[model samples]
Target: MLEEIAIEDLGVIRSARVPLSAGLTVITGETGAGKTMVLTGLGLLMGGKADPGGIRPGAERAVVEGRIDLTRHPEVVGRVDDAGGSVDDDGSVVVVRTVAAGRSRAHLGGRGVPQGVLAEVADELVTVHGQSDQLRLRTPAKQREALDRFAGSEHAEVLSAYRAAWTERAGLRAEIDDLTSRAAERAREAELLRLGLAEVERIDPQPGEDAELTALTSRLGNAEELRQAAQRAHDAVVGLDMETEGSAVHALEQARRSLEAVAEADPALGEQAGRLAEATYLVNDVATELSGYVADLQADPAALETAHQRLAELGTLTRSYGDTVDEVLRWASDAGLRLLDLDDGDDRVTAMRDRVVELDDRLAELATRVTAGRRAASDRLAEAVTAELSGLAMSGARLEVEVRGTEPGPSGADQVAFLLEPHPGAPARPLGKGASGGELSRVMLAVEVALATAGDEPVLPTFVFDEVDAGVGGRAAVEVGRRLAQLARRTQVVVVTHLAQVAAFADAHLVVTKATGGDDVTVTGVQQVAEDDRVRELARMLSGQEDSATARQHALELLESSAVGR
Candidate 1:
């Protein structure tokens, strides 16, 4: 429930606070006293579009703030929390909206949020009905929604399941159509994949084979040059003629002999002679290894040709698949998997078609259940709404909910319509054609009250009626007030009305009055009237004369009668 709304610098309401509570609260005022501004403030809090022109002259911004009690609406609290906002320990949240310079901003639970968040939260909190809603009630979609809401939660679950099944069936059918239409295309693609896979299998390239073969080919091509270089090094290390004393080995041996002879005179000389002997051994080992290398070196043209041919085959695989042998191998592995899937296309399509058929049967059963539920709900809804219409002074009017068969859809295979029978023996016609503006208002209210009473849970935490009694008056207006009080008994109701009878029934009555300053600047104020003040306000609303004794008496009588009705 909305605890209170504080509006500032909006239209003629420069600053005003409208207190609200858990029962019917009506705001009454004369024609230009800013009564609509109060609702405008509520609209802004509900995240409606903000009009910059509604801002007061000389004011930079317009602000509308509301304090809502969420103790009974934990779902709304969860929404606020999800938007990074927190509720008070008492289960209350403050929603604030500001409009300035053609832009709007919203804050919930003191946390700044997108305007859409405010809309989402507010949708669950309040349902606003006005003259426009009366016309909306004529729409088939709205009529169906009303019936569904009356159908309660169990029916809602069925509808949900049906919609899910419908979506799945639609997807399956689309896939089946695609597969059937592209049969030739898919066959051609599978053949191409088969050909490519066969080629890759025949070549059978291995990872790193291209690099390994390149190295072998280079070695074979330079075998003769390598052998010549190795021989020259070998001759230099030893000597072409081993008998000559010009080789490194002979020189080192001569040095070792001299150093050893002087070793007894100098111990350091002995260490140097040992190192020279080790160096001579290492040189001889290298000369032996070099001779072996020269003997092994051979230009095998046949092996070289075989290596070149294998490299060419690997290159062919790389050119079509990847930049290297390893990459080609990966492509082959992926293609093999794709080929398996392609091979199973017909089987997969047949399975999907079979599933679609199963889904069709399931959907038909659910749709039948849904249609049966709707028909049953529509009867109850029609009877209940008709009962409410009788209380709204349309005792002769009856509402009929018609369920007709239609193609299966997300909602179901039923097209629901609301028909109105103006009186006995009158043909039932669609609401738009049979009901007057005043009758539509009553019917819309009847539907709301019926919906509220149909379900275990209340329709919403709060309902705001913006002159739902626009064209209603006399005893009918009094009954409208009574019915509103009845609804308020179950949930909070706020009405912006000009009828004294309706305003008199409100547990809380607020009056909007316009005052002009010495400078001739006009402003409006909203004050909750009480006792004699309430009577006088009602009197003023009754005959445009608060001081008239007759109107006052009439207003007093209205209060007495409404009290008895309550």
Candidate 2:
């Protein structure tokens, strides 16, 4: 619901704050006092197209700000948050739109956002009905939407199922088309994969095999040097080709023997003798192991040549397939799976075709159910709207909700439209054919009331009527007022009206008055009026003179009647 609107340099409204609340709030003024500017300001808040030309003369920019309640609108809150804006803890959001030169900017909760974001959130937060909407209600598509909304969740359930089936069918058809069109391309892909797999199979790469081969080749290439080194170590440790006296083990053994001779006269000497024995055994063990290594090590030219040849072959595989053998092997594994799928494209296409047929049958069944539901709801909606029209002073009126079969879309296979006959012997025709502007207004109002009562609860948070009572007058105007007040019981209502009867039902009344400055600049302001001021405003609406005592008495009676209606 719109809590308040602050408009600056917009049209005749130089700077004005229009406070709104959760009830019927009406804006009224003389013909040129800028009543429509209030709705224009609201349009800006809702992210409507902004014309910089509408800015007040000599003003550099026009700004419109609105405070809206979001307690019943989490989706709107989520959208604002997604746009990097904050909603107040008390469930209110501030939206501001600024128009300067040839461009406009939108801000939500102190954060700049795209105007599109505000428009998207506005859909769930408010519904603005103007004279244009009365014409729109005659169109088949809009009437269908109204019927669906009035049908509530049951028709929605069937429509959802039908659309889901239709989407599945479309997906299957698209896949089939793609498969047929790209059959040759897919075959070429399969052939390429097959060739790559065959090369991989012949090479038979293994994980870490290249690294293992490299180590073996290095050892085989240096076989002679390795053997010479092992023999020299053996000679140093024991007495092979050289003397063991230069070896570390031999030196330690010599020291241990000297210590043992001295310790023989004491207990510590026995421990030193054991240490010399262990050192001699360790030196003998090392010499034996080195001698074995030298015996096993051989420089075989044939084996070395074979290792080099194998490395060259593996190198070819590595360069073409991967930097390493393991990566090449992984590629082969994934390619094999893809190759299987590519080879089975024909079978997959056939499966998809069969599934499409299945979904078509399902969608047809749901469409039939949807049509039935709409036909049943059409009768109920027409009856409710006709009953509402009777109270609006069109006593003999009848609303016919015509449901015709059409090609199925997301909404199902029905085209719904409203046809009205004002009285007996009148041919039932679409809106604007036989209905006047005032009749259209009443019809729309009746439909809104019927729609509101049709649902378990009101859906839109606020409803704005921009001169919807365009051609209505007298009791019909009073009925319009009563209906608006009735709607306000469910949600917030903002009306731009000229009728004192319609204005009488408003819980809050704002009158727009223009003040011309000495500099010849005309500025407009909106002020909430009460008691004597409200009576005067209503009197001005009833008659050209705001101070006429007869008009004031009539205004008083209208207010009294509106209170009694509540």
Report lDDT per candidate.
Answer: 0.88, 0.85
- Least accurate 10 contiguous residues by lDDT in model 1: 129-138
Give per-model TM-scores: 0.72, 0.82
lDDT by residue (37-126, candidate 2, tens digit) is 888888888878889999999899999999998988888888888999999989999999999997999999999988888888877777
Q: What tens digits encode model 1's per-residue C-alpha lDDT throughout 343-458?
A: 88889999998998898899999999999999999999999999888877788889999999998888999999999998888999987775665677778778878887777775
Error of 1 at 534 (Å): 6.0
Q: Which one wins on lDDT?
A: 1
Number of the predicted model whose TM-score against the real structure is largest: 2
